[model samples]
Target chain A: MELWFSEDFSGGSRFGARVTQVVASHKSEFQQIDILATEVFGKMLVIDGKVQACEMDEFVYHEMLTHPALLSHPNPRKVLVAGGGDGGTVRECLKHSCVQEVTLVEIDRMVIELCQTHMPGLASRLSEDSRVRVAPDDASKIIQQARNMDVILVDSSDPVGPSEALFQPEFFQELHTALSEDGITCLQAGSPFLGPEQVVKMALDLKKFFPVVHLLTIPVPSYPGGTWCLALASKADWNPRGDSGQLIRQRFQDRGLTDQTKYLTKDMLGPCFEVPAFLMSIFRREQQAVAR
Target chain B: MELWFSEDFSGGSRFGARVTQVVASHKSEFQQIDILATEVFGKMLVIDGKVQACEMDEFVYHEMLTHPALLSHPNPRKVLVAGGGDGGTVRECLKHSCVQEVTLVEIDRMVIELCQTHMPGLASRLSEDSRVRVAPDDASKIIQQARNMDVILVDSSDPVGPSEALFQPEFFQELHTALSEDGITCLQAGSPFLGPEQVVKMALDLKKFFPVVHLLTIPVPSYPGGTWCLALASKADWNPRGDSGQLIRQRFQDRGLTDQTKYLTKDMLGPCFEVPAFLMSIFRREQQAVAR
Candidate 1:
C-alpha cells in the first residue's frame, strides 16, 4: 500500500507528500503536530494537518517573509515574530546585523520542541542564539501590551483556529500600535485563490491604521494554493516602490546579503510589489463592493 | 469512499483535488485522459493522470503561456501552438487582434474533442474562430514543415508520455528552423522544483539555437509542482528587459489589451524575467557543472 498524507484544504482540496516515515506525531493542547520524513520535501512540519514548512523549500518562504520588511525599514533592530514556532522566521531576522533582539511568540510550544528535536537547521537558533527570546504565548495579547517593535512579522498559518484572531482588524490595530512610529510590519495574509475576500479584507484592515499597505505575492509550493500574500504595512509616509526600490537594492548589497541570501536578492525588490492579475481583478471587483 | 485524484511527481510527491464527479474518462492511443469535477479547482482536465487545467485557475497558466511571447514579438501575426489540446492557449492567442492565423497541432485528437464537449470557454474557439486552424497532427512533424511562425507556444505536458519528443534538443532545432528569423517561441519547460536539472538543461538547449533565451516562471497550482518554467527564445538580438519592458506596456495600451488580459500585464514584464531564488541557485550550481 502507498502511504500518502494529504491536508484537506478548507475541506475542498488537499496537497501533501508521500511519507516514507511519520517521524513525529502528537496532539498538543492547541493543535495536532506531525513531523514527516518524505521523499520530495526533506523533512516537513505539519500542524493541525496543515503543511507548515518543508526542509527544501522553507528558505523561500522564510527569506521572502523577513528580508523585504527588514531591508525596507531604515533600521530593524527589534523584531517580533508571531506564531513562527518552526524558528525559520527568527533565523532570517537574525541574519541582519541591525537586528539585536528577536521575540518569537507562538501559540504552541510543542511546535518549537518538535522542531528543535527533528529539524535542527530551523529550530536550533531559537535556543542557541544570544539575541533571541522564545515566548510560548498568544501573539494578539503580546501585541496588546504595545511593546515597541521595529518590525513585526506575522508568521501565522491560514485564518483558522488559533490563527483566525490574527487576521481580524482588532489584531491589525494592535500590531500597528505595537510598532514604532517609522516601523514596518509584514504578515502572511491568506491565499488569494483560497480566500480572496479574506485576503482583501485583511489588507483593508491594515489600511485602517497605515497609509502605506502593499501585498507582496510569494510562491509557497507546499501551501494550499502554492501562492500566498504578505501584507506589508508601514506607519511612515514613505513608499516601498520609491526610486524603483533602489533603496532596498542598495541596502541588500551594502549589508552583504547578496552573498548570503538563497532566495531574496537586490534584484527581486521590484517584483515583490506585483500582484497577480487575477488578484488585481478580485480587488477591482471588491472595490465596487467594499466601501474602503 | 471519498474519491481523490492525484498526479504523483517522480513518485516522490503528489498534489490533487478531491474529485466530486468524473465528468469524462478516455484512453486514447496517445495517453489517458480524465475530466473531473473537483471540489476546489472546479472542472479539471487530467491527461495521463496529470492535472492539465482547471476551470478556476487555468487563466493563470494560459495567460502566462500566450501573452509575453505575443507581446514581445514586433508583430505576432502568425502563431503556432504545439500540444495545446485544451483551447485556452488559442483563446489567449486570438485575444490579440494583430494575430491573423493560429495553427494548433496536437497528437491526440480525442483530448481536443473531449475539451470541446466539456470546457466550452477553453475549447469553443477551436471550432468557432475564423483565424484558428486545428490540426490533428504530430506537433514535431508540423514544426518540421518550416511553418515560419512569428510566435510558437509549446503547451505540452511534462516531458513524458507523448509530450517527451517536444523537449528533445532536436525538437529545439526544429522549433528554430520553423520560426521566422525574428520570431519568438515560448514553451512550458517543466517545473523548476520537480525537475531542476531538466529545467536548466532545457533552457540551455534553447540557447543553442536562439541568441535570447529567457525562462519565465509561472504558477499553475493544479500542476504537480505548482510553479513551472516557460522557456521563451528569440532569434533577434533584443532583450525583453529593454526599457523595463516599456515596449510591452506601450503595446498593451495601443493594442487595448489592458482591458482584456486577466494575468499578464505590462507591469509584469519586469518580473517575467525574475527566476525564483531556488531556481536561480539551481542554475548557478548547474553552470558550475555544465559548460557552454
Candidate 2:
C-alpha cells in the first residue's frame, strides 16, 4: 500500500509526497506535529498538517532565513530567534563566529525535543552550542522582556493560529522595542503569488516601525506558492545589495561559514533583494493606499 | 465526485491540482495535450503529461522567458519562437513594439488550435497580430534554414521526447547561425534545484557557441522545482545589468509597452542577471572541468 502526505496549499492546490513511514506523531498543547520519512523530501517535519521543513530542501530555507539577516548586521552578537522550535534557524545562526549568544524562544518544547531526537542534522546544534539558549515559552511574551537583541529572526509558520498574533502590528512594535539601536529583524512574510495582500500588509506594517524595509525572495518548494518572502526591517540603514562583494567574501571567510552554506552566499545577496515587478506593484499600491 | 490532474515531477515528487473540469484533451502527431480548468491555477495546459502553461502564474514564466533577452538587445526587430504551441511566448514577444515579426515554429498544429480555442488569453495574439506567422514544423529543421533573427526564444518542453533535440549542441550551433550579429537566445534551462546536472549540461553546451552566457531564475510554482532557470546567450557584449535605468525607461516609452506587462519592468532588468550562488558555482565547476 502506498501512503502519501498531502498539503492543501490553499486555492485548491495540493502538494503531495509518498510517505515511506511515520517516524513520529504527537499533539502538543499548541498544535499537532508529525515527522514522516518521505520518498522524495527525505525526513519531513509537519506541524498542524503543514510541512515545516523537509530534509531535501530545508538547507535552502534555513540558510536564506538566517544568513541574510545575520550577515546584514555588522556584529550580530546576541541573536534572538522567535518561534523556531526545530533549531534549524539556530543551526544557521551558530555558523557565525561573531554570534556570541543565540536565544531561541519557542512556544513549544515538544517541537524542539521531537526534532532533536528525529532530525539530528537540524536540531543537534540546540544542545551542542554552549552559546545557545532554548526558551520554552511564548515568543510574544518573550519579546516583551527581551532587550538588546542585535538580530531578531522570526522563523515562524504561516499567519494562522499561533503565528497569526506574530504578524500583528503590536507584535512588530514590541519586536522593534526589543531590538538594539542597529539591530535588524527578519521575518518570514507569506508568498507574493498566493498571499500578495498579506505580504503587502506585512511590508506596510514593518515600514511603520523601521526606516529601512526591504522584501527579499527565495524559492522554497515546500511552501504554498513555491516562492517565499523575507522582510528585513532595520533601525539603521542596512541595504543587503549595497554590501561590497569583497566585504561579504571577507566576512564569510572571517566567520568560517563558507562551507556550511548550501544556498546563502555573498553572490546571492543582490538577487535575493530583486522583487518581481508584480510584487513591487503590490507594495506600490499599498503605499498609495496608505498615502491616500 | 471530484477530479484531479497530477504530474509526477520526477525525484519521487508529485504536484496535484483539483480539476474543476476538463477543457480539452487530444493526441496530436507530436504529444498528448490536455487542457483542464484547475481550481488553483485557473486553466492549465499539459503536453505529454507535463505542464507547459497555466492561467494564474503564466505571466511570470512568459515574461521572464521573453523580456530579458528582448531588452538586452539594442533593437530586436525579428523574433523567432520555437515550440511555443500555446502562443503564450508569442503574446509576450508581441509586447515589444520594436518586434516587427514573430515566427512561431511549432511541431504540432493541434496544440495551437486547442490553445487558441480553449485558452484565448494566451493564444488569441497569434491570430490578432498580423506580424505573427505560425509554422507548424520541427524547430530544429526550421532554425537551421532561418537567418538574420535578432531574438530566438526556444519555448520548448523538457529535454525529452520530441523536444530533446532542442537541447543538443548541434541545435544550439544552428541557432547561432540563424541569429543576426548582435542577437540573443533565451531558452528554458530546467530547474537548478531538481536537475542541477541538466542545467549545468545546458549551460556548458550553450557556452560552446555564445560568447556571453548567463542564467537567470524566476519562481515558477507549476514547474518541477518551483524555481525555473532561463539561459540568455548573446553573441554581442550586452549585459542585462549594464543597461541604465534611463535607457530602459526610455526604451519602454519608445515601445509603448509598459502597461501590457504583468511581471517584466525596466527596474527588473538589472536583477534578472543576478543568478543564485549555487548556480554560479555549478557554472564555475563546469568551466574548471572544461579547462582541465
Candidate 3:
C-alpha cells in the first residue's frame, strides 16, 4: 500500500508518495519493472517504479495508439509498431481487415514474453491473429529498413532509460523516412498537465516533419497522474479512427470483444485533441519563446 | 501557498488538491465562497471550503446552463435564474434578443459581488444589460410567487451547503410552477465524475415535474473536477439548442469581449454531451437505481 509517486495533471509535475510495500518486482534489461496492481485502480503496471498502465483502463491508451492512424490510411496493407511489446496495439490493428501484415519491432523480447505469460487476456489476442509479426530487435534500425508500411505506430515508453532515443528528433526523422506517402504514426507523449512544455516541444517538432499532427488523450489510472498523451503524425489529413463508417462496430465481430471495455469510447476520438486551454497557452508561449 | 486539496481527473477519484490559502474568497449569507483556480484542466472554483468550478478545461457547464433551455422557449420575455449570481449564467442569457428581463435569485449575493470585483471579465457584460435584474432572494420562495416567466435557470451551486434543497424533487416542482406551460429550465447537476448519483437523482425528479428531461455537459474552469454536468428540462421535448438560433458564438455580441475568455467554442455546443465511459456508467447505474 505504499504510494511511490504522484503527479498533478492540471499542471505537469510529480511528487513523492508514501511507499507502503513492494508487492512484486522484476528487473528488465533497461529498467526495473513492477506490477503493483493496486486495489484502487484495478491492476497497475509499474515500470522503473513509475506507473505504465492500469488494467481496468489501459484501453484508452491502447485504442488511441492503435486506432486513429490504422483507420486513416485508405488501405493499410502493412503496419509496423515500435516498442509496444504488450501486444495491445497489434491486437487492435488485427480488427482492421485492411491490415494484412503487422511487424512489432521491440528491443526487449522479455517484455512480450512476460505479458504473454502474466497477462493472457491482452496477449491472447496477438497469438490468435496470424498477421502479427514480432521482431525482437532494435526499433531505431528496424524502422529504417522497413518500407511499404501504410501505418506505423510508435508506442514507446517515456523519454528516459532505454526509450530515450524514441523522443529525439533523429528517431522521428527515421520514422518519417520509413513511412510510405500514406503512412501514419503515433507516439506515446507524456502527460501534458505535469510535463506540458515537453509535450508541446515534441508536438511542434513532430508537426515540422508531418503534414498533420494530433495529440490524443487517454486516462490511464496507473500513470504518474492517471492521464497520458499520445502524439499522432500523418503525411495526409488523417481522419481519426472509429469514424470509419461504423467499420469497427460492425466488424468487431467478437461478442466478447464488444463487452470487455471500460474506457474506449466512439465520442472520445476527437475531444482527446481538444487540449486544455492552459496547456494550449503554454504551447503558444513556448512557440513565442522559440521564435525569439 | 499551502496545498489544501487537489484531485486528478485521469481516472477514478485519485487526483484532488486542497489548498489552505484562499485562492479567491467572498463573504456571503450562506457561507464564505473561496476558489483555487488551479493550473489543472479547469480552474477549480472553490466556494467556502468546497469546489464550485474548475477551468483547466474539458466539459461545458457554462454553455449548457445558459444556452439550451434559454433558446428553447420562444420569445422568452422574462427569465429567472435560481442561482449562478457569479454572472456567467446571466452573461449567456443576455445574448438572446427575446430575453427582455432576467432575475438572478442567488442566496449568496456576495459571490456575485466578489465575482464582479475580482473576475470582472466574466461579470462585465452581465449586470450592464438593462434587461437583467439581480435579486438576493431565497429561490424556493421566490419561484412560487414568480409569474409570466418564459424560462427558469436553476444555476445554483452543488446540492451541498445552502443549495442542498435545490436538487430535491420539491424544488423542481416549484420551478415548474414558476415557469409558463411552455417554459424550459436548466440546472447545474454536479459532474458525472463527482456526482453521477446526483445527476440521476435530479434527472428522474426533474422528469416528474417537466415533460422533457435531458442532461448536457459544458467545460468550466472553476469546478472541483475538470468536467461538469448540467440538467436540461422543459415542458417540451429537449431538442438541440442551436436549432432555435439563439446560440452565443463569441462571449457577448461585442468584439471587445474576445481577449478575456480562456475557452468556449462555438462548434462545441452539442459535442460536450460526450461523456467518458466511467461517467456514463454512473448515469446508467443511477437510472437503474431510480427504476428500482
Per-model TM-score, in order, reads 0.97, 0.94, 0.76
- Return the lDDT, model 3, position A69: 64
- Model 1 chain B worst lDDT run, 10 consecutive residues: B237-246
Q: lDDT by residue for model 1 over A88-170, one digit each (tens)?
A: 99999988988999999998999999999999889999999899999989999988985679999999987788998898888
Residue A3 lDDT in candidate 3: 57
Error of 1 at A289 (Å): 2.4
TM-score of chain B of each: 0.96, 0.96, 0.77
The number of the candidate with the highest DockQ is: 1
- TM-score leader: 1
Which residue pairs collide in model 1, if any?
none
- Residue-level error in angstroms, candidate 1, position B52: 1.5
Window of ten residues with lowest summed lDDT in model 3 chain A: A10-19
Residue B91, candidate 2: alpha-carbon lDDT:
94
Q: Pull out the clashing pairs in model 2.
A: none
Q: Is candidate 1 or candidate 3 better by TM-score?
A: 1
- lDDT for model 2, on a 0 to 1 scale? 0.86
Candidate 3, residue A21: CA error in Å?
7.8
Q: How good is the docking of model 3, by CAPRI class?
A: incorrect
Across B1-292, the per-residue lDDT of candidate 2 in tens digits comes to: 7797888866467788889999899998878999999988989999988999999899988988888788778899999999988999999889887789999999999999999999999999999999999999999999999999999999989999999999999999999999999999999999877788788889889989999888888888888768898888999875554554346556766777676788776656666667666777887888898899
